[model samples]
Target: MSQNVKVVQRASSSVRDKLYLPAIYDGMKITFKHFFKNLSDINAVDVLRYPEEQPQDITDRYRGLHRLTHRPDDSIACVACFMCATACPSNCMFIEAQEREDGHDEKMPKSFSIDTLECIFCGYCVEACPCDAIRMDTGIFSLTGNKREDFVLDKEQLLANKGAFGEVCSCARD
Candidate 1:
């Protein structure tokens, strides 16, 4: 093969070009504009007086706190085969499996916890569960706490769909 080389050169900017900083000022100007706009519209803004106010409508797609769906008889629907644990990219899902009794429709989670502190809330665990037993449809995306143990989501909390109120939500039907 023949050896060949080609070179291209770009012209350097001048001191005047270096001195110009409109991009930085443009960013600052946007921030200042937003700040002033907020200041002027402070009263009109719908800032929730959260202690006294509540939302009436939330999107169905909102991924909030997780829920473990229950059968009509109040038994957990999860088979506890560790699919959620395996599907969780963040490794937040933990499961303890126990075999079902004779003729039972499903196996039960002897123990199940999604370590919320470690959960990235990507919804993979919810999507991976084949049995339609877990969901994140409550619109409560934030779960706050002071310790790691506090974020270990428990069965009681997992079972309470709140206003979903012991009923199946849209995620289940889909």
Candidate 2:
């Protein structure tokens, strides 16, 4: 194999280029200009008051809160495969698997909980799900709670959080 090398050339600077004051002055000039413009047109600008008013256009790529899909029988679609928990790099996902008591399902989560504080929102859990039982398409960016325990989403909360388009599951078993 032939060796490949890159030669980078640095342009020489003049005396004026060495002076930082001119660059600082130029930056301040632009900053002041924009400041005056914004001050003058403060009323013209539309500011979104969050909690009360949310943005109308929510993109599909926006990763929001995680929700577990439900089967037609009003049961969680998750088979307790643990793919989501295994793929989670943050180790935030916790799942307890148990055999399905009813004849209808294969296996169900005894306790499915996700600590929102530890979750990095990497979307790895969503991608690893083979049954499409878990999704981050809720379009809910703002998640808040008065206490730490409230931020831990349980099975009930995950099931209750339906996406704007509705809960979608493509599991073949269902």
Candidate 3:
């Protein structure tokens, strides 16, 4: 079998193109245009003085931070199935299961923690949970901590977090 090989000629660059002055000027022109426009109308630019001005356009679908939901009796909805941890692509979630002592005969997480530093905030854990135990609807995107351990939220911390409406549990079942 014979294969036909096609050769293409390369385009030659002119002296102006080689100098790159035109490209630089075009870039500068666009930069100056935007700069002056923003200077003339500050509102036209989407610059927010953060801390003082929080984002107001966060939609309902926006996944910000993780939170644990609760049942009608205010018990954690997590059944310690490890579904959230398994679905987490970043391997940031950790859980320890224990038998429920409330005569329920079901298993529950004795300890559940998430390393925010390692978390990618992909919302996979929230989606993988079968009991709707976890959710990212807290709208608390400003995650900051001085120490590494502070970033790791425990079961109590996760349960304490509230949604935008100050509701501790956003469980749909409740």
Clash counts for all predictions: 0, 0, 0
| Better model by lDDT: candidate 2 vs candidate 3 | 2
Question: If candidate 2 were superposed on the true structure by all CA atoms, what would the RMSD be?
Answer: 4.7
**Predictions: Cα RMSD each:** 4.5, 4.7, 3.4
Which digits, one per residue and each the tens of the lDDT, describe model 1 over residues 75-164?
Answer: 677777688889888888877777777344456777788788788888888888877788877667556688788889987788875534
Cα lDDT tens digits, model 2, 1-174, are 998899988775777778877889999999999889989989876799987998888787889999999877777789899999999999999999999976656789999999999999999999999889999989888889899998999999998898977666677463
- Kindly list the per-residue Cα lDDT of model 3 for residues 63-109, writing each as its tens digit: 87788988767778888999999999999999999998764437889
Best-matching candidate per TM-score = 3
lDDT of each: 0.74, 0.88, 0.86
- Best-matching candidate per lDDT: 2
Order the numbered candidates by lDDT, best leading: 2, 3, 1
Evaluated against the true structure, the overall lDDT of model 3 is 0.86
- For all predicted structures, in order, the TM-scores are 0.69, 0.75, 0.77
- Which candidate, 2 or 3, has the higher TM-score? 3
State the weakest 10-residue window (summed lDDT) of model 3. Answer: 165-174
What shift in Å separates residue 43 of candidate 1 from its native position after superposition? 3.3
TM-score of 1: 0.69
